[model samples]
Target: MQKKNQLLLVVLCLILFGTLNGFGQKNQKNNENTNLKTSPKLVVGIVVDQMRYDYLTRFWNHFDEGGFKRLVNEGFNCKNNHFNYAPTSTGPGHTSVYTGAAPATHGVIGNNWYDKEAGISVYCASDDRYTSVGTASEAGKMSPHRMNVTTITDELRLHTQMRGKTVAVALKDRGAVLPGGHTANAAYWFHGADEGDWITSTYYMQELPKWVNDFNASDAVEKYKKPWNTAKVINTYLESGSDNNTYEGLFETEKTPTFPHSTPNLLDKKKDFEIIKYTPYGNRITTDFALAAIEGEDLGKDEATDFLAISYSSTDYIGHKFGVNSKEVQDTYIQLDVDLQNLLNTLDRKVGKDEYTVFLTADHGAIDVPAYLSDQKIPAGYFVYDSIKPKFNAFLQYKFGTANVVKNFSNYQFFLDHKVIKNMDIEVAKVQETIANELLNYKGIDRVYTGHQMMQNNYTKGIPYILQNGYNQKRSGDVLVVLKPGVISYPRTGSTHGSPQIYDTHVPLLFYGKGIRKGSMVNRTEIPDIAPTIATLLGIAFPNGTTGEPIAEVLE
Candidate 1:
């Protein structure tokens, strides 16, 4: 009897130990599940339009401690970030940054491209199916339907079952629309009419929200119409070359391109509210609108992650009007630094300090004014599109014994009239090769690629690779043209970006906040990497047609 009792007690002890071990295992599993579900409250993608990579270093000393300086000291900075495709215009830049795909896959080749089917040029975001929601103007008929693939924001919304909110704000419509994706909660851009109101399209909603209406009624543009002057004294902007250069474009009101000018004349005479976009005040207005969006939508206040895309378009406008080496450009950067500081401060207070993620980059970087380069004795010249198009048409006609064979010559590419060519029984490939060979002989032309070659995926490395990434057979032109280094096809007065040169392709890229490390990486990264990096942090699948790899250095 004693032996039996001892054995029974041992069996009960073993049973109790097994139960405790099972409970521990279940607890551990639950903790692992919780860890996998964790994510930041908000993700902010800031695109400073036309920002060059050197701007951070160029303006480092002038930057405030809490603004650009803070980001550099406490965030992961990709010092050598670059755009991977050619035709680095606003539309393609914004679309590529969020889609993780190039223009070839995303179908936004440039700001505007000649549509063969429509037999006319088509704007990147223009959709005739939708009407304006906030204003009577056609500016509101914008949507992201042209984008072929899903964006990072779209993936986030899908992951959360449409619970996540995505909002975009900018001074330009394409800057806001492309990054907001198709299923965004709302996308807003400054309309600059009847006292400057924010507008949207029927693609997102049938009517403007009550908050937007109230904000528009506030007459925000009236506040920015003050006597404009430099942020710091004129001489302090030493790196900008000179203050009054003939290369800069003057405003409608000002005689010379100097500062301390007032905008009351702009509003008083022409009622030109559009003038404000050319100044730093445009950046301020965009920031205010973004803050309103965050508060109004209650973004980042819930468990699911939200996205807010802000593109400061005034920089591009200012850069275009005033050359990169002008006092106006320098002053604009200084003022933008303050605006950035205020924005980060607000984000810290609204969404807890480390609960949000932010990345600041640019749509594209601008080239130095060709005139400025000429003065510096650099071999730079303006390749006049007007002069080239007529010659290209004549050349095509000479080859095919028909007039109007070249339908369009824009965006450094030629569009052949395929319908006319077929009727004339002209082989498209032969015409493309002929144009390519002839275009190469043109002055300031570096190399030319035929549409047939691109369509067949027969391209060499380097610039050809970039052209291939930007080429969409249906949307792009029939013959691709690349200009020599430092050559621009736009106005000689200021600067523009479209080439695959280092200056146009290079841009600033910095990442901060949740899941980010306080370090810098010198790795070569491209615009498409931005989307995949965000997706990786959120533990979501990459955008559908993603061709970019995740920036591993930024991931936690």
Candidate 2:
């Protein structure tokens, strides 16, 4: 009886230990699943239009701890970043970022350019065959049909055989269409003449998705109408120049380009929302749409990787209108900091800390207003277009008599009527050289390189700094013109970008979250490197025709 009782106690002890062991294993399994669900498989790419490097430091105090500050403190900040090509406009900027290639390869030279093949100026993303799926007018018709190379987003979708979702959101059509790549699930951009509404092109869908349509119809624009005031006191914006400067572009409702603007009158107009493009609130609207997209699409939910390309376009619009040193510019950065903080917090809640990765960069930076430079006793001056236009025409008239040699010269590219040149039997090369030589002699002019020369000269040296940084053979001008220091192409109303100057080419690049090293890199980095870095992070192949290497400092 004693032996039997001892045996029974031993059996009971074994049973209790087994039950506890099973519960411990089950708890461990639950924790692992939770971690897997929270962390994203890949990345989110955020490109801010016309975001200069200095803006980060300029408005650092106003940034929230969770937003811009989190990115800076936690992420690998590329202190010296820039575009490698001339004409740092929206199309090339977006193309370069995703393709990991410059305009020379990606082929989006400018926003609107004269198509030598069609003998007419063409919009970069415009597709006449496809009408706007979300809006009534064809003006909203745009796609990535013109893009020549695959984007990082395209590669991710391809890796998953189109099962993974890829989405892009921006205020500008090209901003959405290009970065999302050709195979994106959808690319939505802002629409509406008076009240901005987000819309998508037929390239991705037959109609606005139910979620997007609902979001737009909700009338979110009313939230901004509460009040329009500067984020801080006007006098506090001492970093910026005088408010009533002559070079600043006029806002739709505000007179004299001064602060303390009221929006009641502007909002009364049919296209009042257009003004939002020039305000920091535009970034807020864009972020709101982006969050809706993440939730509606269920991005990063499954095992497959997803991609989200978001371009905040208001910075570009505001930079163009207010110049770099206006009170408006300062306010925009401060508000943007706050908006970024809100965005980061949302991402943290939705995606979880370190679960998703983000890369914040710029399409391009801005140049200081030439007038401001001139006031500072710098040898600054505006591009003498009026003076050069007549000279160019005269040179053309002499070369091709009785022919319209000049169709148009804008966006730093000269479009010659090739039909006229062919019929007149004019020497195109000689005519281009003559024009180039003439322009090179003008004030504030640097060296000029014909397109042929740029293509052929593999070892050209002593090239003007601007030309060296800005030139891309295929899509760039037939004759590349470089400006002397402090000289801008656009004469009036604030600053312009398109030169290879440090002010325009230099931009900030910060990569934080998941696998990025915590440190700064001063090594020269171009926008093209962004795509390859993302591709490496996801373990995907580099973009086809990529000339840039992955940024080594940030990668494993």
Best by lDDT: 1
Worst 10 residues of 2 by lDDT: 460-469
Number of backbone collisions per candidate, in order? Answer: 0, 4
Global lDDT of each model?
A: 0.88, 0.78
Tens-digit lDDT string for candidate 2 (1-556): 9999999999998998888888889998996666445435547899889888998887787667877888889888898887877777888888889999877788888887767666677888988777786777675677898888898889888877888899999999999999998899999888747646888777788988888888888867667653457888877777888888787987565677886666556767654577667777788899899889888888867778888889999888888888988888888887887777877777777776676789999888888888887788877888777876676667666766742766767676665665676777767676667778877777778766676666555642243433443455544567767778688877577767877667877888999887687888888887889888877777678888587788989964
Q: Which sections of candidate 2 miss by over 4 Å? A: 1-39, 399-403, 417-427, 459-475
**lDDT (10s digit) by residue, model 1, range 1-556:** 9999999999999999899889889988886666456578999999999999887888777889988987888899999988889899999999999999999999999899888898888899999999998888888999998899999999999998999999999999999999999889999999986548899999999988888888888866688987669988887787787777788998886888887867778777877778889899999989888988888889899999999999999999999988788888888889999998988999999998888999999999989998889889998888887676677668766777865778878898888888888998869998889878998878989999988888887564689888998998779888999999989988867778989888999999999998888888887899999999899889888999899999988877
C-alpha-based local distance difference test score of model 2 = 0.78
The lDDT of model 1 is 0.88
Candidate 2 clashes: the total is 4
Error of 1 at 388 (Å): 3.6
